[model samples]
Target: MAAGGVSPGGPLGAYVPGTSLLHRCPPGPKLLGLLVALTLAIRWPEYVAVPAVALFALARVPPRMALAQLRPLWLFLAVAFGFQVLAAGLGTAIEVVGGILLAVALASLVTLTTRVSAMLDALVVAARPLRRLGIDPDRVALLFALAIRSIPLITEIVRNVREAQCARGAGNNPIALAIPTMIRTLRAADALGEALIARGIDD
Candidate 1:
């Protein structure tokens, strides 16, 4: 991607700015919506998941773009569905996968609509009550922010690693990709930890 260019159909959690109703909503409400969507998706029938997934897409961007966000997981989802079908039945597989996809979609919506700073602020505020129990809200909020921000970084690392492997004619080798990816991920984590310590934020 070019400087400041939007990545084409990045997986969920990549925020896209928009002028939709969801974008206008506060983070707290959006978080609540995510919770509600997840609850309904998990506790209700499999069919309910379809709408949940759709709503997540429609709220963020066009349906096509939303689907693109999920493209990366298509293989995993397919494998999971296949396993479920073999273990149980087609209907059960559909239900299980649908529910998972729905949850993923709803979560993507939350991150897409809400800015990272706003998310951290909301988390800090929400965690205030826990401060009485000796929990540091700021630390908790930082952890959440790190987790969200790390998703895209990790994705990029994987993409770069795959490309490097492909250049060396190892593109089709899963082991070749996995080994380097794991090593790079660990190095990245170590670097991140070192940076945090340097900034005196490792607490």
Candidate 2:
């Protein structure tokens, strides 16, 4: 998020340079494949493993790096799996959790191999057909870009807030963490909006 001093393969967001098959693949096809795989994973959880493994291998993403990306989601995954187990059964829990992990892993691989600029350009091109429907492809692409960039920014904000809370002995108080994070996030949004307007992207 600092734009420097962060690993390209870090859990946040950055492109990892590689010469693997996935790295060589164009963003358009990679995105299409991701969409198909995600749909299939949702429909048939067992199918998730196949593509997950294949994608990691093709991307030449180290197992450690892939796991690093998932590390942050462990708590959410555990809670989801546990809730599913209590509500349904272990099999159902596995399917649900597996689908979620597969989705994240697949999406992570795409971002890992594809540069953000390249991905945004690909999105603009992909959205071109929607121009007939009164949609602006450039704006649509910009939205996606912002969403992608915001994830890491928000993550960093949360981390900083949590650290400050702990230092202040707030000890994981949800309100303490949430309020400051929300304020900081809003300020960030305001700054981003102003910057856009200054650039004449007010629309």
* TM-score (all chains, Cα) for each model: 0.58, 0.61
- Residue 98, candidate 1: alpha-carbon lDDT: 80
| Sequence-dependent TM-score of model 1 | 0.58
- For model 2, state the Cα shift of residue 99 in Å: 1.5
Distance from true position, residue 132, model 1, in Å?
2.4
The window of 10 residues in a row where model 2 has the poorest summed lDDT is 1-10
What are the per-residue Cα lDDT tens digits for candidate 1 across 18-130?
Answer: 87888888899888877877887778846566676566656757677667668899999999999999999999898888877777777877777776667768778999999
Model 2 scores what on Cα lDDT?
0.83
Best by lDDT: 2
lDDT of 1 at 87: 99
Per-residue lDDT of 16 in model 1: 72
